[model samples]
Target: MKKLIPIFILCVLSCQSIDTPEEPETVLEEELMIDILTDIAFIRAAKTSSRKVFDEKGINPESYILRKYGVDSIVFAENNAWYGGQLERYKEMFTVVKSNIEVSKIKFEKLKKEEDSIKKVQDSIKKATGDKKDDKKDKKNKKNKKEELEIDDAKNRAIEEEMEKARVKRFNNLSGKE
Candidate 1:
C-alpha cells in the first residue's frame, strides 16, 4: 500500500506536467508584444481618465488592439500566458514598455510646447498684419482652439497618470518578484 501511494503521487505529478499547454503555435514577436502592452497601458490610462467617453463612443480598447496587431484574443492570450510563465523575460519586456512610454511622454511634451510656440507666433503675426476677419470666422477659430486645447489637456492627463503607474510598476518589479 505504501509503495502504491508513492506511485500514485508520481503519476499525478506526471499527469500535471502533461496537462501543461503546449507552446502556442503562433507566438507574437517580443517587440510586437511590447508594443501591444505599451498601448494597453495607454488605453488603461485613457480609460481611467475618460471611461464615460469611451463607453459613449463604444470604443472597445482590447478588441481594437488585438485587431490592430492582427491577432485574435486567443492568440494574444496564449502569447501572454507564455510570457507570463517566463518571469525574467516578461520583466525585461515590461521594462522596455515603460521606457517607451517615458520616451513618448517626453516627445509629446516637446512637440506640444513647440506647437504652442508656433501657434503663438502665428497669432502675433496675424494680429500684426491687421487682418480684419469676420466675426463668424473669429468665432469658429476660437471654438476650434478651445476644442484642441481640451483634447490636449485630456491627453496630458492620461499620459501623466500612465507615467505614475509605470513608475510604481517599475519600482515593484525591481523589488524582486521571484
Candidate 2:
C-alpha cells in the first residue's frame, strides 16, 4: 500500500501541467520577427565593432529597432517568450535571421567595393583635369562643380526619403496596420 501511494503521488506530480507563458495579443508575424532579429544582429555587430561610436552618438540600438518595427518592449518580450517555448520554431527563426545577416553583409561589402571604385575613378579624373587652366576658366569650372554638387545632394536626399517611406510602408503592411 505505501509503495502504491508513493507511486500514485509521483504520477500525480508528474502529470500536473507546467505553466506556459501567455501569447501576446499582438504577436509579431514570423517574417517580421525574423527581420527584427536580423536587424538586432546587425546592430550587435556594429556596436561590437565600434562601441565608442555608438556611445558618442547616444543611440539606444534596441529601442531604435523596436520603434522601427512599431513594437513595444512588453509585447516583444511576451512574443519572444512564446516563440522560444517552441524549440524547433525558435531554432528555425534563428537560422533565418543568421542567413539574413549574412546576406546583408555580402550586399554591404559589394556596395562598399563599388563606392571605392567610383571614388578612385573620380579622383583620377579630377587629377587629370587639375587646375592648369586660366583663372577665369578655373573659376567657372569651380562654380559649375559647386552647382553639380548641390544638384547631386538634392537628388540623393529625395531618393533617401523615398526609400525610407517605402520601408515604412512595408513594415506597416507586415504588421497588419495601415
Candidate 3:
C-alpha cells in the first residue's frame, strides 16, 4: 500500500509537469529559428531546377525572413549560436524546418500546375477568337519579339565583356602585374 501511494503521487507529478506550458521566450525563439532555417533551405532549393526541390521565384531569403517574421540575419545568427550546443533541440528545429520545406515545395508545384492550366485555357480562348483581334496582336507580338531579341543581344555582349575583363585581370595577376 505504501509503494502504491508513492507511485500514484509520482504519476500525478509527471502529468502536472507535462501540462505546464513551455517558457514563452523559448517557444518564440524556437519558432523563429525554425522559420528562418526553413526559409534559407527553401532559397537554396529554389536555385535548382528540379521539381523535387523548392521552385518559388524571386525570393530574397534574408529580406523575406526579415519582412515576414522580423527575424533578420543577426537574430538568426545569435539564436543559431545559442542552440549550437543543444543537439536535441537543434535537431528538433531542423526536423520541423525540413518538413515545412517539403510541404511548401508540394504546395508551390500544385499552384504552378494550376496556373499553367489556366494559361493554357486562356491561350485556347485567344486562338478561338478569330483573325480580327489576332491581326493587332500579331503586330504587337512582332514588335515585342524584336525588342526582346535586341535586349538578349545586349545582355550577351555585356556578359562577354565582363568575362574578358575577368580573364585579363586573372592574366595580369598571374604575370605579377597587379
Candidate 4:
C-alpha cells in the first residue's frame, strides 16, 4: 500500500511537468539565433559561389539558390548557415535553370532533326513533284507547325509534373507538426 502511494504521487508530479508550457522568451531567442546562423551561412555560400551579388540584391540569395537547385529549403537552411528564404528560392531557381537547360538541349536536338527532315522533304518534293513550289511550301509549313505543337505539349507536361511535385512536397512539409 505504501509503495503504491509513492508511485501514485510520482506519476502525478510527472504528469504536471509534462503539461508545463515552454517559455516563450526562450523559444524566441532560440529562433532568433537560428535565423542569424542561417543568414551567416548563406553569406558564406554566396561568397564561395561568387554569387555575392545576391547580398547586394537585398534578397535572401541562399534560399533562391537552394530552391533553384530543387533542394528542400528547410533542410538546406538547417544544414547551412543561411535562412530558410534564400535556400528555398535557391532550390526553386536551381530546378528552373536545370530544366531550362534540358529543354534547350531537347529543342536544339529537335531543331537539328527538323532541319534534316526539311532538307529531305525539299529534295523529295523537287524530285517527285518536279519543283512544285506551293506544294513544298505547304508541306514545310505543316511539318513546322506539327513539330512546334509537339514540343509545346512535351514542355507543358514536364513543367506541370515538376510543379506538382514541388507543390506536394510543400504541402507535406507545412502539414507536419514538427
Highest lDDT among the candidates is held by which one? Answer: 1
Model 3, 26-123: lDDT tens digits are: 33468777877888787666555454433345455567766787655555565676676577888998989989988988998999999999999998
TM-score of each: 0.61, 0.61, 0.47, 0.25
| Candidate 1 segments exceeding 4 Å error | 1-22, 131-178
Q: Could you report the Cα RMSD, in angstroms, for every candidate shown? A: 33.7, 31.4, 25.7, 36.4
- Show how many residue pairs clash in every candidate, following the order shown: 0, 0, 0, 30
lDDT of 1 by residue, 44-152 (tens): 9989999999999999898998899898899999999889878799999999999999999999999999999999999998886645565668888999999999999
Worst 10 residues of 3 by lDDT: 19-28
Model 4 residue 55 CA deviation in Å: 84
As for model 2, its CA RMSD to the true structure in angstroms is 31.4
Give each model's whole-structure lDDT.
0.90, 0.89, 0.76, 0.63
Candidate 2 lDDT, 50-80, residue by residue in tens = 9999999998998899999999988888898
Candidate scoring better on TM-score of 1 and 3? 1
Using TM-score as the measure, the top candidate is 2
